[model samples]
Target chain A: MSPGGEALSRILYVEDDHDVRKVATFALKAVGGFVVEPCESGQQALEKAAGFAPQLLLLDVMMPGMDGPTTLERLRALPAIAGVPAIFMTAKVQPQEVSRYRALGTLDVISKPFDPMTLSATVRAIWAGRDD
Target chain B: MTELMGAEAEMRDALRRLRADGVQRLGERVRELSAGWAALQPRRPWDDADRARLGELAASAHRLAGAGGTFGFPALSKAAAPLELLLLGLRDTPAPGGDRLRQAGAQVAAVAAAWEAGPAGAEEDGADPGQASPAEHGEPIFLFAEAEEQAMLSAVIANLGYSVRRASEREVLEGALPEGPLSAAVIDDAVPDPLAVCARLAGRCPLILLAEDSSFENRLAAARAGVEALVAKPLEVNELADWLDHFAGGRAETRYTIVIVDDDRLLAAAYAMALRQAGMQVTSVSDPAQAIEVIAATAPDLILMDLQMPGIDGIELARVIRQTRRHLSLPILFLSAEQDTERQILARRLGGDDFIPKPVDLDRLVTLVRLRAERARALRAVMESDSLTGLLNHARFKERLGLELERARRHGTTLSLVIFDLDHFKSVNDTHGHLVGDRVIRGLARSLQKRLRRTDVIGRYGGEEFAALMIGTGPEEARGIIDHLRERFAAASFETEGGSFGVTFSAGIAGNAPGGAGPEGGAEAEAMISAADAALYAAKRAGRNRVMVAPA
Candidate 1:
């Protein structure tokens, strides 16, 4: 049932919200054409970093346990997550703020209240932007 | 999920009861007012005797208008709005007809009747029942203070827009500053120790230190604690409001960048050092051309530019900076040796905060820069730049002055305002090339600054004019200081393009004395300037180059 664009190109999705995870999990499986793994917290993501071996990480900025930025900082410390293409999802995506996040090594930010239809395509686009 | 549902149900039930309580309270007040009106014994509903009764009814109507919304009876509240308007109309109408009286009376009565019915029709009325209620269930402000002094202190903090929750009486920290997004938080120097609180909210919120005692040790302690600012006791509420506004606007409150553009390496280094001493994050550029690019990347809080540059002049740099968004509100204070009113006015008009005529008055320049940064952070909503010296922008000064005012109001402290002006700044500019003339002005800033207390505030008010606020000082003492500054400035030997020149300044001093009003609808600090301005003018009229004390 897969388009078979890429296999085992690990995807790590960190979100505190369960409903968002449920919706995203389905979209990634059906449309993303890649392996998808979901984690609830930055700490949890850090713990599963070795085994999951994600090529790309999608992180939610605002969360209860360890925020996205802090999580990214910790991830940068780990050699496995180093140089991994990262994207942030946040409510604040103003030009100046986005630039700051970009300066911190984030390739792009997918704004919150994201489109359920376009989530997979956007991630694919970010992945492409990195190669170029 | 079940637990969450239970919590929602509890909230819904609490809101329902609150509505019922609001309605009952409104009904009781209305009935009590009605009885009072009946006892007044009016001859006719339209007569002058009914004036107090109408007033009482209007008061009840006003109360219901606010109260009704609490219970989700928004329509009842909206219906009561007309009564306020009608009552206003009646107050102006000398002889009102029975129709007006009957309408007002009926409206008030109907509001009371509606509330008495409880929150029955609230849902059907197209109002979000929950929207009409307070965010939290009635939680009376509690402060954990063993002593009355501490309690009073807590009251002051509570009044300043903090939800001070009392933890335990033994707890040194009063209440935990709610762990939510806060614009800014106030940490006292001693009790409710700010170190832990600042650490908790660090990088999340800007922290302001309220200094109970203005001692070197205290200030050092505050600085080590990583506080954004140290606002001494007798703080200004306006200043606090400014800090809050800066944070609320989501501007960087942690560190501010000041761009110094100069052709002279030595001079640039000196100015940068002075700015750093004032605690500003400084970026110094030896060339004027780099001002645009440097400012573009990281928008600085303020800019200090050398008037004379090798390629593009300081004025041109100022114009270019004005064109850039990063420098839009960026105060560009010219570090020039240009002293003409027309030239200074030109720089000011080009969006320059103020021009520090060189050989930069190190102390005054530093103080002015700090004040300007504070003002920029505080009054992001208002105009910037001081009128004289064209330094310490207005919005920035207002924020600092506001903090000073709030502190004064809280701590029962005295703040003095001193206004001083160059006795013949115009003639000097005319006689000497505005270049040499500017050196004299900068030199004067240095002299005057030397005469001030370390805590005193001095800013260039406008052309040949300056204002100083001496905290915890009286008018007499302020007058003495101002008079001394004037004498020293007059005696200074200023070397210019032509030759050495001597200059004199005139000053006026006023205190925020009891029953005192700010002159010209500004503020206490401003009023003091007005009094001082008037005194300065008087001194000029009495013959230039003398100091005049504001009339007691």
Candidate 2:
């Protein structure tokens, strides 16, 4: 189940780093069996959001030009990804900072230096625990 | 259990295949990141550009730290985490000092070297992945030589995977300089009048000269021609290719200092650990009374202080710091658990730049500190740096000289100064207009800034004149460095309306060498300056574009 209490299949992951995006895509696809569409930046996420019609948004927090929280805010303005839950991935997440991410309407904050092995499982847990 | 064991085995095999395919590329990425980090190293005091670059480095390192751990290089991740933290803290503030930057750079270098070494079995045969292939990043190497020579060299360069662009000396001189950024340039010394061609391209890219003769005269000519490396002909193609690869791979790095003050030892340690992990040189003071002394000694770019202490509170401490003329503009950030709006407002009024509540979120704290520190640094740059050349201004230069001189005397170390004045600078201004003159000055400033070691203090002492304070350097070593720079400047061509022209400077070195008469106080600084000036006159009298050392 998705964080929105729906079956999560398609994930729109927005991360600027090419390597991180590649590894995350491998985890979600090969391990979790989810269809993952990756965007390099917030602007790219917006341009591809509607066409891809992703069920979840996995956004990196510290990106050049436009960051994750700003991306989510812009995406919320659009009808396509509006109310679609996002989970922020950032090295900056302290416990209080995680609360700030949650207040931004994200499903949760996944601190960076994350284990690739359990990443897919962690996302699934967050999905299952989502109130909506 | 048997079925599960079989499934786990299958997964392990798949993971191994993935790693084998991916690790090489990941290693390359790490090297690229390291090079980028190196390129961002601040040559001077932190400015707007340096701050922006710091932010970029932090963001990139943050990504690497996360991805590196996930991909089985836990060591790489561990190495990058501190860099990320350090950059985040330094992103907004002026860098702390050169020593701090060096420490941070060493940390990054360690990580980069580790990645280049790679993990056992990650590679097919333990070959250094960095040397495996030339970067296929679409950047082309420009070859400036005769037609026949170009044919032989282009093939070797191209074989290494770099795109090669060929141009003859005549083509380059006729204003057919390549349109894009070049990876490197190869020039055959047989070309007629190659100095002019080489001079134009000197600092633009790395230039390697292929010479038929290795005679002293021929090598001297090549040096005068502004090429970085001169190859005696019958060029070993493999060696040339390796040199090209090495030239293409260089990048930058920098470090910052932070001072953390809190009455709670454990809390102070926590903050210090976080900052240090980011590769920052951190000084923590748990006793409020010691804060002033530590701050004075460190002269840190940012002060992270807790609000409440036994003897003196953060607000009062900040006020005391502000009262001191030297640190009046220093950024003071309060990290406290106090939630009272009135008290926070009072702290702000007493010169607190920012306030973070207690049990501070480490990430947020770092970001906040960096922003505040960077802003303070940029403001300092405006007051401290010359508007035209971006070096230290005359006043700041003298001020810093006094400080360095005093420090050298206390430590019983040598301090050398080089005073340089451009030759025929007035004529250039008259003939080519002031704009071109300004360009020449700026070019020389950039050259000196780039070429000198980070410890050297450079300043625009006067119009068409510059001075550098080489700490821990004697007169002879200072002269050698100055002479090298003179040669480089003489080979550099400045663009003018009349076409490009070369400019050179005459320099004089004066130092308080060991067992020599040294400056006793600020008054004697003027005498030392005069000595250098006298030697400079001697250089101009003997010949322009040369260096002279003051007699003991």
Candidate 3:
């Protein structure tokens, strides 16, 4: 259970790479014990986010069409998921880039080349760190 | 727990399958990236059409970088990253330098090499990279111990990521000198004539003595011989590693002054603010044309540049900078939206330090910049310092004098310049040998350093003569400080091999000569120095071993 007073069970995961998505979905579901709905690109995530009613928005930074940051901006405009918390997962992010991401009201950024075994624990820690 | 174990077992099997499936795609991706190697010729005309082709290549590399690390090959991602960055940077350049293009080729070659050697890492693709500590120190540590302890000691040090150069204690006693410029040396207490060996290695490198019993007498003897630390025989490897790090970190740490040249004002301002917060002095120049003036005036420790600018690009500006003899070796790091390859090659040839790919992780940038500046500052200190005594050299002292004077005048504050000459110096050298005379000089230099404020610039002006620039102080205050220094030296005991001896100095101080706020040409700097010289002559005539101040 998160500080939001609900169990963080459903995560709307967006990533363009099929291999990464396949492993991450397994990491979130089988290893992490969470119900995961995966989207292949930013466009698909935007289409599915409204109906999923996810506990969190797990977005990838680089995508083919809309990209991570842009998708977050567009998804935020919708009434259903306007105030939902978001986190960015990327390969590398500089300190300044982290500041920029934070200014867009992100919870935290998990770096890529991340160990799949510890993926869920990282997300749980992020959840625990936030008070509200 | 059993339920979790079942899930974990399934996860590993899934990981193995992911690697088997992704390995084919990894090979194809590297092949695609390598396909455009011929098009990256440095001599070829770089225009809009070439840029389009390079963009396509960069997109491919970018995809590979994001995907490979997640699959079986993290090395594949690491290798493709630099090439992708270089291509992305080069595509934006209107006329990229030849050297930068060559750098891109090298990165591409590296990608090919990484792919060849990548399968070894892929076997355990799901393993965590965070467990490894990056502990590779460049300088080798010197070891002088018993032959029995050599293997165990070297293994422990090597595991901590240091290369150890070992020597037997018997070899040293036989006068077989260890090759050094070594950072630190570890010696054993069991060694014969350990004090003699310690004396030789003391000032050259940090000495850590490994004591068999670790007694009080051993500590005292180690301290007397100038060993930095004495480690007990049953080694606390962690504690030993800490001491090594502490000594190595004690290099001249100066506050680096940096200039950021970019067209983006907001970006430059952000970086400047960040650097300032990190205890650095930073200046940001938005206009490329005005950047040259700023760079010249500041003579900054480092320059952070952008490859693409409006008036003149970073390459042309770097060329202009390299043309100047003084700034030829100044460290310049390129920070741009798309960083690397053609621009990198060109920048390296022009003596640029590194290409920090953007959007840069600020922590890495700060650390790298600090490391580069620390090395530059340390080298500059060696150049500016007097060899015999670590005070500023004669020429550097005078240069500091002018700068301090101008700064004091600008701030509407007082500054004092004092010269100290050892009295009866020729007679002392005649009575004692030249070595004792040199010891006396070093003794005076040490006393001055101990007594004077850190802000005061002290220098060995000549043989047996020293000068100090004391800012924000009046003549009366300056005279009081020097008077204390004079009495301290006259009474203080200086023990040498030739036996105990004492020395005194005559000091002349000049201050507030450039007084009053007259905007246009109030006082000349030459008059102030002349006044100090006259006062010194007066001190010599009246009596030596006293402090005197010139009339304002």
Candidate 4:
């Protein structure tokens, strides 16, 4: 297998439980060979402004404590991140809500229970299509 | 190499164990502190001595806060926040300067002590959060850094039923010095430069600064900065709380002084007591000869004058007052045991606002005094208001017009003037009674008031004539509004004792003219009014009940 250097370019992964930080950790490091940071709260991801800081920031918008909009405000405060794209991974993403999230400063939001097999490749394609 | 690696791994494991143990201990300490703090409640019946003892108690609590969090007892440190703030405040403002501080300390201490006594204290002092009103607890706090310190302070104060917040560094001085309803602020003088902080905070809030040592210069500077006082550090929290309580409490009700110009000593004293009970400041003067001196000095809101006194009768005194010109509008209530209606009417004609019969009903007398005082304030407002048409009077109008003209000229806009007069108003007063004439004038004023926009001002210019200022309105719109008013006045009817009769008025509208327009069109607003007046006179001459438009 090709050194997996190209596979490390983008990542899309989801886990509802915070206790399993190691599961996403192994997938990012060994399988996808992607740089990854694990977070317990959607609030932390927004605070970090991963969208502007890196090539991608996969979000679980319906996390406990601070919900999506609040995280969005914190992310928006970062001036460098203007229109740096975002995507929400939710278990219940209706087509209407997907458009709503897209309207709310997101490029695309994927439905949850996404196949781990194709996750990294799918995320890479999405990133490649981004104008920014 | 393998042996060295094993040693490094063992050292790392040891460090992890220490961190874990430290976190657990911190969590336990926080729980204990929270439990201890939740027990605090304010207690009553605290004397001055109890308030003074609060300083020592606060010092101990301050030490606890400084040590508890550092020792991994975050909860205990957190619990000490309000106590630390209170203690620091008390320590900085000891003795006579913070008498209220002592009372507040006594209350906090009593509650804290009661809480320490366990379940019984909790049952007795348990705060019904629902019962606690925002008024007592809405003491705003300025946020500062030191998350644990702020949290502890907020918790302790919150338990005491005060709303608390972390003050920003920039706002710390302002937070310490409250402008409006704040009782007091516990200010730390150790921040970078203490004197500068004191000066900034003192500008707004009454600052009770934490003094490290007794320096006379520091005290003098604090006083100059409007700081209430400085209490040396190693604080007594209770005494500071007491000081906050007193100053933060409602101010005493306002008292009015009534100087009685009656000569009977017993009666004067009786009236004085009655007025005092009615919450007024009373000065009794039995000698009418000293009336002017007493009146000028005391300046009571109302004067109760005794008619048929030993030296001067009430009517003559009333006339003297009217003659003073300064006291022309002063309400003089005549106190006459004299039971004659003719005398009462004569007293009123002589400028007595009211007549209190002999054997005055204490209640009626009190009611009359309050009524007169209120009316006096109203009259003062009215003296600045136009008397005839109930708009701003001439003096106020001139000031407003000048200001408006300056603003309009600055912005390069037009200000217009309109002058109105009743056509043959002299005939109305002459043919009909003056009462009927007054009704017609009032009717015209009401009609103008309703037809014009709210921004327009209408003031009676002497008798049967009025003036109006229309801001930002051009000559066309001003004339349109004036014409509408004239038409409305022509259609309106005035009711008199005899019968109702139709009334009419003539108006002239003029706008701000260019500098070289004419003598009548100069930049001076008076020119505009005069130009409008000229057109108004022309309208009257031309015919009755018509609009006369002046050239811009």
Q: What DockQ results for candidate 3?
A: 0.16
Top candidate (TM-score): 2
lDDT for each residue of candidate 4 in B1-552, tens digit (9 for 90 to 100)? 999788657644653354345335434433443443333224223345544445445544433333232223322332343444444454344332232344334334433442343222232221210111223334443323234444654563453334444455555544343222233455556555666666665534456666676589878887886668676654333334334433332222134568898875544554554465345777888889888878877756789988878768888887887786557778888777778999899989998899876555444677899899778857766776666556667666665566566656766777777777888788888888787777666666655665667767667776887777788888788877778767766775654546666767888877775432433222466776677888888888888688777865
What local lDDT score does residue B529 receive in model 3, on the 0 to 100 scale?
Answer: 64
Could you tell me how far off, in angstroms, the CA of residue B242 lies in candidate 2 after the best superposition? Answer: 26
Tens digits of lDDT, candidate 1, A1-132: 114344335788887655456556555765556687889889889998768889888888767669888999998899988978799976433446678888889988875444343467667756654643
Model 3 agreement with the true structure over B356-451: per-residue lDDT tens digits:
775555446778888887777778778789988879998888777766777777777888889889999998899887877887887788668757
i-RMS for every candidate (Å) is: 17.5, 15.5, 10.3, 22.7
Q: Rate the local accuracy (lDDT) of all candidates.
A: 0.62, 0.74, 0.74, 0.57
Superposed Cα deviation of residue B446, candidate 2 (Å): 1.8
Q: Which docking band does candidate 2 fall into?
A: incorrect
The reply for model 3, stretches above 4 Å from the true place, is A1-9, A91-96, B1-7, B36-53, B72-75, B89-103, B119-552
Model 1 TM-score is: 0.27
Please say which candidate is ahead in DockQ: 1 or 3. 3
Worst 10 residues of 3 chain B by lDDT: B128-137
Each candidate's fnat: 0.00, 0.31, 0.29, 0.00
RMSD each, Å: 29.2, 21.7, 13.8, 29.7
